[model samples]
Target: MEQERLVLEVDVRVAQPRAPRRGGVELDPIDRDLEYTGSLLTLLDPLGLLGGVTVVALSLTHGAFFLALKTTGTIREDARRLGTTLGAVTAVLAVVTLGWLGLLTGSAWSWATTVVAAVALLAAVAANARGREGWAFTGTAVTAAATVATYFLALFPDVMPTTLDGGRSLTIANASSSPMTLQIMTWAAAVFTPIVLLYTGYTYYAFRRRIGTQHIPEPVAVG
Candidate 1:
C-alpha cells in the first residue's frame, strides 16, 4: 500500500507531457519494468499481508523439536526433511521460472539473467540432494541475487514508465536524487554496510558446525 501510494504520488507523468498512452501497462506491449514490478508487487502484497502463516507454522513445528529429543531426534532430522522439501519446491519453481523466462525472452527482456538464475537454482537442488548444506544455501542466495539483478537489467534506461506515456517514463538520469543526497547515501552505506555484513558473516561461520540431538542440552526453568 505504501509503495502503491508512493507510485501514485511521485508519478507526475500527467504533467510530463511525454508519458505513454494512459491505459494500464498491458502485458501484451510487454513493458519489462512495469511487468516485473507489477508481478513482484502482486507476489509481495500477499506475502506481506499473509506473513502470519509462518508464525503459525513455526508454532506447530515446535512440537517436532520436542518430539525429536524424546523420540527419533528432531533438529538433524528436520534438516534432512527441510532439504528434501526445499529441493522439491526449488525444482518445481525452477521449471515454472524457466517458463516465465521464456515469456520474458519473447518480451525482449534479458535472457542472460534467467540463465544465471536457472543455473544457480539447479546448483542448489544438486547441493541439497547431496546434503551439502552450505553449498545449497549459497546456491539459493545466488539464485535470489541473480533474479534481482535481472530485474534491474530488464529496467534499463527507465526507472518507472507511465503507461499513459512511454515517453514520460522516468530515466535513471532523471529519476536520481540530488547529487548531495546521493553522496550522503553512498557514504552512509559504505560506512555501515560492511560492518553489518561482517557481523552477519561471522555469526553464520560461527554456527557452521553440525550438532546431533545428543548434543542438545536440557532446558532449565528460570527463577
Candidate 2:
C-alpha cells in the first residue's frame, strides 16, 4: 500500500504543468497595447506624404512617355485610344487628390480648382493622342509640380502646431531616423543615383524615336 501510494504521487508530480519562467522584466499589458497602437499610428502617418508625391510625379512622367511611344502608330489604333483613356483617368485622379488636400486645408475654392484641373487634364490627353507631345508633357509636368507643392504645404502645417508637448514632439521627431543614417543614405544616393540617371538618360536617347511595327522583332519558329 505504501509503495503504490508513492508511485501515484510521483506520477501526479510528473503530470503537473510547469509555470512560465520569469525573464528580467515583463511588459505590462497596457504597454504591449500601446506598442501595437504605435505601430498602427506609424502605418497611417501623414509625414511620408512627400514619398507619395514623388511616386505620383515619377509615374506621370514615365507613363506619359511610354504611352506616347505606344500610341504613335496607325497599326495600334486601339492602343492609342487606351493610352488616351488612361491618361485622362490619371489626370482626373491627380485633380481629385489635389482637391482632397485643399479640402483638408479648408480651402473655399477647392471644387472649382479641381474641376478646372480635371478639364485641363482631359484636354491634355486629347492633344497628346493627336500627337502633340509638347502639350502632353506640359500638362503632366504642371500636374506633377502642383501635386508636389500641395503635399509640402499640407505637411508643414500639420507638423507645426501652436503648442508643443513632449509626446507630440517625440512623435514628429522620431518619425524620421537618426542624422547618421540620413548621412549614409545621402552618401549612397551620391554613389548610385547619378549612375542610374545616366543609364535612364541613355535608354531614352537610344529609343527616342516613335516605335513602329518594325521595332517588334520577328518571332522565331519553334521546331
Candidate 3:
C-alpha cells in the first residue's frame, strides 16, 4: 500500500532512459528516469484491497503454523487445529490472488512458482493434520518462499508497476544503484551476514526446548 501511495499511483516516467547501466541491470521500456508527476490515491482499489486481505490471511496462517510447531500441550494442540483451518482459508485466498497475478502477468516462471506454492501449502496442511509439526513448519516456509518467487517472477523487469500507465512502471534498471555502491553492498553483506547468522543460531540453540504451562511459575500471593 505504501508503495502504491508513494510510487505506483503516480506517473514517474522520464522522457528518456538512464545512461550507462554498469550494474548489469536488464533495461526494458519501463526503465526510465524518475520524475514524479500526477495524483496519489488515499486508498487502494477493490482488487488491491483484496490483495491486502490475502496477505494478512497468509501471515495469520503462517503464524498459526509456527505456533503449532514451537509450543506444547494445549497451545500446540490449539495452534495445530487453528493452523489447519487458517491454511484452508489461506489456500483459497492464495489461489484467487495468485491466479489473478498469473493471468495478469502471463509469465511462465510465475505460473511455475504458483504451482510450487500451492503444493507446499497443501503439504503443510497435510503435515499439520498428521501432527508432524516440523514438516508442517518446513512446508509453510517453502510455501512462503515460493509465493514470493511467484510475485517477483510476475513482476519481472519492473520493480514497481504502475496501474496508471504501464510505461510509467519502475524497472530494475532504473532502480539499481551505481556498480561501485552495489559492490560495496555485496562486500558488506559478505562480512556481516555470517555474524548475524551465527548469533541467530546460538540464540536458537540456547533456547531450543519446548515449553508448556507446566514450565510457568504460579503467581505469588499478594498480601
The root-mean-square deviation over C-alpha atoms between each candidate and the true structure, in angstroms, is 10.2, 12.5, 9.6
TM-score per candidate, in order?
0.60, 0.56, 0.78
| Residue-wise C-alpha lDDT for candidate 2, range 127-174, written one tens digit per residue | 768867667656655655555555555545334222211223213464
Residue range 1-223, candidate 3, lDDT tens digits: 8988767445555443342221222122332345443324313344456678887887887888778777899999999999999999989988988887777674988999999999999998999999998888888789889988988999989786653333477778877999999999999999999999999999878877877889999999999
Q: What stretches of model 1 exceed 4 Å from their correct place?
A: 1-74, 94-109, 221-223
- Misplaced by over 4 Å in model 3 are 1-33, 36-38, 162-168, 221-223
Q: Which stretches of candidate 2 lie over 4 Å from their true place?
A: 1-65, 106-123, 157-172
Q: Which lDDT tens digits does candidate 1 get at residues 68-181?
A: 223334564675465556555554555454444345332245467767766876776566566555566666667666665655666567555444323255669877999999
Which scores higher on lDDT, 1 or 3?
3
Best by TM-score: 3
Which scores greater on TM-score, model 1 or model 2? 1
Winner of 2 and 3 under lDDT: 3
Could you tell me how far off, in angstroms, the CA of residue 46 lies in candidate 3 after the best superposition?
A: 3.3
Residue pairs in collision within model 3: none
Error of 1 at 33 (Å): 18
